[model samples]
Target: MGEPVARIMVVDDNEMNIRVLEALLSGRGYTVSTAHDGEEALEKIQEEIPDLMLLDAMMPRVDGFAVLKKLKENPKTRLIPVVMLTALSDLDSNVKAVELGADDFLTKPFNKALLLARVRSLLHVKFLLDELESVDEIIAMTARIVEAKDEYTEGHVERVTAFALGLGQAAGLNEWSMRNLRRGALLHDLGKIAVPDDVLNKPGKLDKEEWDHILRHPEVGASILKGLKSLASVVDIVLHHHEKLDGSGYPDGLKGDEITIESRIMAIADIYDALTTKRSYKEGMSKETALRILQEEGQEGKLDERLVNIFSQLVERGEFESLGDRIPNLFNIPPPPPR
Candidate 1:
């Protein structure tokens, strides 16, 4: 089958330019829409999200750059590819359009063939991104189910997910990497289900053998979740969250870069929450104390430095205040450090 016809919007104040774009794009079998000016284009955009926008740089009231900024700012319209069509072929204009998130650029005397090619390329990219987003949503849904099973850790997934996301973002993780970190954070402790309730909720400190059994949860959880096709990526995270950077942690004793960044971020978020939240055995540590422990212990190379720092910053910024409430206000936690 032939490629799908792209929906293209041609935005130009000049009637001649709009006519040229409509005619040229329509000749190539694209479904074309024309807008006389930026204001009209914005209204048309509100009606239908086109696959590609061929925008004129100069327009009254709202210029191309202004329109592009608005489109990029709105989550609903941000993903639509925009190609700025302008008479100003200067480097400054080209750079400005790109900085404002224009996907492509066309000079006033644009080549019809080049225009078609650019539109096809941008649309293809958008399609791939949309598919990836769908996959991410599916993964997130599955993680949420696992998180819901344990009420104490119910909101644990989201809080740790947010902390991991913040850490990953601060460390310059790519979009795919950040999403994986989120999935890992949600599913990291899934193996705890394998441990007997007596052990999982013990009110006293664990003995050596009990601690050994507890430490095996990561591998056990990894094994259980790995069999499922949807959770394949997260299985690795579950298995490695307990693995320390110094090779002192967990089932396999894997260390450092052997652990993926997703696993590393999950480690910090997991450990920090574990410290600051009540378990059956002990009262939760205060946020100030938890932050200090992470900095001191994380410096030993057990956790990612950047992730620990980001967690500290988020705590300083009050990202986890509501987290303590998720499990319960059961513990009258002490006040956190000054916001």
Candidate 2:
């Protein structure tokens, strides 16, 4: 079968401008939709999201800048490539549009060839991004299925992602680091899939052999992700999140600064969630008790002192949003293969 036709939305107040662009795009075998203003475009978008959007920088109410800002803020429509099409060719307008997440900028009376090229390029990128999203969904769904196997640990992945994200933010991680932290936290236990169901769902404390199987999970999970170059940093988190600062922790026995701060943050988050969440084998610890254990570990060099301190503060301040409820946007940053 041939490639699917790309749907492109043209948001322009001027009827003539919309007609001209629509005709050009349709002649090239592209699907076209037109909206007179940003408000109408946004409404239509909620119903049927287009693959790409060509927006006029200036319109009546809800102009291109406003539209772009709203779209980027939303995880659902954020990846839709937006090309600014308008007469305002000034540096400031172009800069503002790009800053607001416009994918490309083109002035009115734009060359038909240049406009088509940009559209084609952005559409190609959007296709690749869709594929990447599919991969993320598969991994996330697999993790959820694994979690579902153990009825007691429902919502564990999401809660850990939220806790890690909060800690990552409090630790002053950049956009890139925070993105990795989110994925790592969500997929941290993916290795558990290899373990037998009987072992994973066992209610009683594990025998030495069972405990050994559990200890291998970090390395198993890391090996699962190591080949994907895009997830190199995330691989570190999966492999080392179980490691302690005192070298008593898992697989490779990494210690001190040898464990990256990203891994360190995941360690604390994972421990805290495991401590507070009730399991078949043990009752959940109280918030105060959990916090005290974390602090004691930090002071005793079982976890990073600074990050534990920051996380404790966040928990006390209730400063972060609860991302577990918004499972769709839990990994909202849609990371492309990092450089």
Candidate 3:
């Protein structure tokens, strides 16, 4: 089969320039679309995201720099490769475009050959990136399937993710750490899928062998995720979330410094959600009781003390109160204590 035709959006205020680019790109077997201004381009993007965007540097209402800034800030539009069409002498605009995440630049008084070449290169990169993103989506979908297994545990992952994010923000984690924490928290319980449903949903105390199977879930979850290269940073959190600082916890029994900060943060969130959330085996504990348990755990060196303190404060301030409403089965739970 022949190569697939790429969809390219050309955003220029000047009618002549738009026609020139549309004709040039269309002749090369690309499916071309045009927007007269940045606002129009963004609107069209919302309707259908193009594979590439050729944005004009200077427009009356919203300039190319402003549009690029918005695109880079939005997760949905951020990955669409953009080439800024600017005047040849506009070095400042060129620098600004790079800062705003423009993938490439095409100076005005365009060269058909250079434009086509840049378009080809950027589209190739976009195709590869879309492939990687597709893999990540598949992994996330698997996690959702695991969540769907136990009705009692519905929304458990969502609550943990929300609480972990609040804790990470309170602890002043950087963007990369925050991202890892979110992904790790969402998939932390993935290993539970390997446990038999009868064991997982048992309303009574677990026997020794049954408990061992439960304990192996962390390793099971890590094993499932370790095969994906994009999730490497998150595997440690999944594997060691149950570990304690005193080396008394399960799995690898990792001690202080041996555990990643992301794992440590996730541990606190996991415990809090597990305690405060109701299940078939036990009723949900009060927020005060859960906080007290977390405090005791931190004091005993099982969890990070500083992170626990931050999380407690956030809870007291009702930072995560709204999160309960977002989850499917958590709306009936009582609100946390106010500060």
Candidate 2 backbone collisions, by pair: none
Better of 1 and 3 by lDDT: 3
Score each candidate by Cα lDDT: 0.78, 0.86, 0.85
Give the C-alpha miss distance for residue 84 in model 1, angstroms. Answer: 3.4
Tens-place lDDT per residue, model 3, 103-198, is: 988787878898899999999988877666565556566768888886778788878878887888888888778767777877899999999998
lDDT of 2 by residue, 10-106 (tens): 9999999999999999999999999999999999999999999999999998999999999998978888999998696688999999899899999
Residue ranges of candidate 2 with Cα displaced over 4 Å: 1-3, 37-48, 58-78, 86-101, 150-152, 317-339
Arrange candidates by TM-score, highest first: which order? 3, 2, 1
The C-alpha stretches of model 1 lying farther than 4 A from their native spots are 1-7, 16-33, 43-48, 58-61, 69-78, 86-101, 105-118, 168-180, 189-238, 256-262, 278-313, 323-339
Predicted structure with the largest lDDT when compared to the true one: 2
- Residues 226-282 of candidate 1: C-alpha lDDT, one tens digit per residue: 777755777888898877889997878888789888888788888887787776667
**Model 3 TM:** 0.87
After TM-score superposition, the amount by which residue 184's alpha carbon in candidate 2 deviates from its true location, in angstroms, is 1.0
Rank all candidate structures by their lDDT, best first, as comma-separated numbers: 2, 3, 1
Give candidate 2's TM-score: 0.83
